[model samples]
Target: MTTITTRTVEYPADNLTMIGYLALPAGAERRPAVLIGPEGTGLSDVERRRAEALAELGYVALAFDLHGGRYLEEPEEMLARCMPLLADPDRMRGIGHAALDVLRAEPRADPDRTAAIGYGTGGAVALELGRDGVDLHAIATVNALTTGRPGEAARIRCPVWAGVGSEDPIMPPAQRVAFTEEMQAAGVDWRLVVYGGALHAFHHPSVDHTVRPGVGYHPRHAQRAWRDVVALLAECLPVTD
Candidate 1:
């Protein structure tokens, strides 16, 4: 296993003091970086572990915060907060850019070689950053096939990849069509992968807290999605020794 270091980082975003997790590979040589966005429930151990995994792969990774430092386990509370945030593109960009700044500021991160990967609400933020014309080398999202304003997608300059569960009610077929149409119209290099026999948040593990119907875990699909995401990164943002 590659040696890596992890730490907590604090930054300002969405009118709150966001607490994020930073993971860096061993050595002082600068390396490609990735911005990790967590689901609407906020930053948790899941995202932190992902960052560490990326670090082990030799990329600096930062798991950004969503709701300050709170993790909303209640579905009602999560929806109430995420619904409004999702409706506002500018707000989402603010959060994404703030986290990007933190990632790029890291001494070991090569700011010019960066990508953003997010889940759920975080995925929406990642899409917003692309739509806002952030210079991302690659963008990948799971369970957040959100369509942006009118022609904003044309501003995206990098390849985009999205993963979704076949039975995700929140991101139904029509929504997926709309998202793909937007990407196609913008002439962006994009692809979508639908995991068979899965539902919303299939990539996430089953939680102890109550979750909405149609939301459950699929261990196999989750691993498959992670492999796909890693493949996307390898293609768009390869790490060098």
Candidate 2:
């Protein structure tokens, strides 16, 4: 059976207990570490599976709780609970730093080889962490709503790979364009994968919301984006088996 450990961690900034699940790769000795932030729905089974999948790729994965293990089926409720964290960027900044600290503290994780990947609100949060000068080696985002606007992108220090569906309504193309221009001006090594035939949260099969036709999860595109993410992390972290 695949080996994994489930536990809870405290975010010292807020002292809120966040339930975390850590999965290890085989024959681990300070493996490359990845911090996976949950979507707006909080820490779901799919999120855990995603973390485990990351571990299978020869990296240590930590699945973080976005909403403290609570699941909200209604969009309105999720918005109500998530707005506070988003409104105060400082909170995300602190949480992201804490997550990185947790990864670095892991005996089986390589501090030098660290990357963070997130979906939805978490994606924006991860990007914000990079913007705040957190020294994260790499970043992967899936359909993030915010992108630090035009001026803030210059502050990002790490390589960022943003994966967004062409049909993502929440994050408009204009915003993506502005974000791209900002990255160029800042000289940040960043790339974007605009999936031609997918909707928001394409990698997350558990989510049922779709805006329109021809805008759903294209498995082929999702798999390719994931491969690109892994390859990018390997290039940045250079973890050796």
Candidate 3:
């Protein structure tokens, strides 16, 4: 008997009433709340399930829609809405913090054990949240690039993990290599895994864009990545075992 519900949150910063779904595990006390960010395509049904899965694993998971319910059909259109936030990372941090606030404020969610995960451009937003010096327990990202902004890598105060597709052109391997190096140099506790034969949208199963070369699906990678995320949250979130 999972106590899950969905709601629309009106963030005061941008006056954006972002629709968010929350899933609460049954009988859980002082549970961790994970703020999940939608992909570049926005909050698809698949993302919802992913959040629910996290919720099933003894967490209060809240998946937020970054696009205000107007999902675009093309990458360009998605970029239009995502770019402005990217240009001024402060605003991006606002969105993540706002969503996180909404999650912690939930009756079933314990603010003490909070974390975040994101996909695609949304991953960038999650990173911004981490860089904003918020007190987060853990942060996980998929298919996201390193922002490389000065003073950012030094701001993370929690365990971090990232999943990348080996052949993801958008998040090229070389760049990931550099990102790892930076994380190492910063002495940040981070884990990065590259799925050997996967592409950019490996975690997104509802896509048929795999027909295009160097872009597609990896059911195996997706499953593994999803499992890894759950494991990370369980391991990182505040819990007394």
Q: Which candidate is the best by TM-score?
A: 1
> For residues 1-241, could you state the per-residue lDDT of candidate 2 as single tens digits?
6565555555543456666777778774778888888777677777688778877777888877666556666777887978787777778877777777887888888887778888877787788887887767888888774656446666777898888888777667997887777778888898888988677767766354433433356677778877887888888866686
**How many backbone clashes does every candidate have?**
0, 0, 1
Residue-level lDDT for 230 in candidate 2: 80
Among these predicted structures, which one has the highest lDDT?
A: 1
Give lDDT tens digits, candidate 3, residues 85-171.
677788778778878888889887888778889987678778888888778898899998666577588888898899999889988
Q: Candidate 3, 76: how far from true, in Å?
A: 2.0
Better of 1 and 2 by lDDT: 1
| Candidate 3 lDDT for residue 122 | 74
- Candidate 3 stretches with Cα past 4 Å from truth are 1-15, 208-213, 238-241
lDDT of 1: 0.95
- lDDT of model number 2: 0.75
Predicted candidate 1 versus true structure: per-residue lDDT over 1-241, tens digit per residue? 5489999999999999999999999988999999999988989898999999999999999999999999999888999999999999999999999999999999999999999999999999999999999999999999999999999999999999999999999999999999999999999999999999899888888873356798999999999999999999999999988
TM-score of 3: 0.90
- Model 1 scores worst on lDDT over the 10 consecutive residues at 203-212
Ranking according to TM-score, highest score first = 1, 3, 2
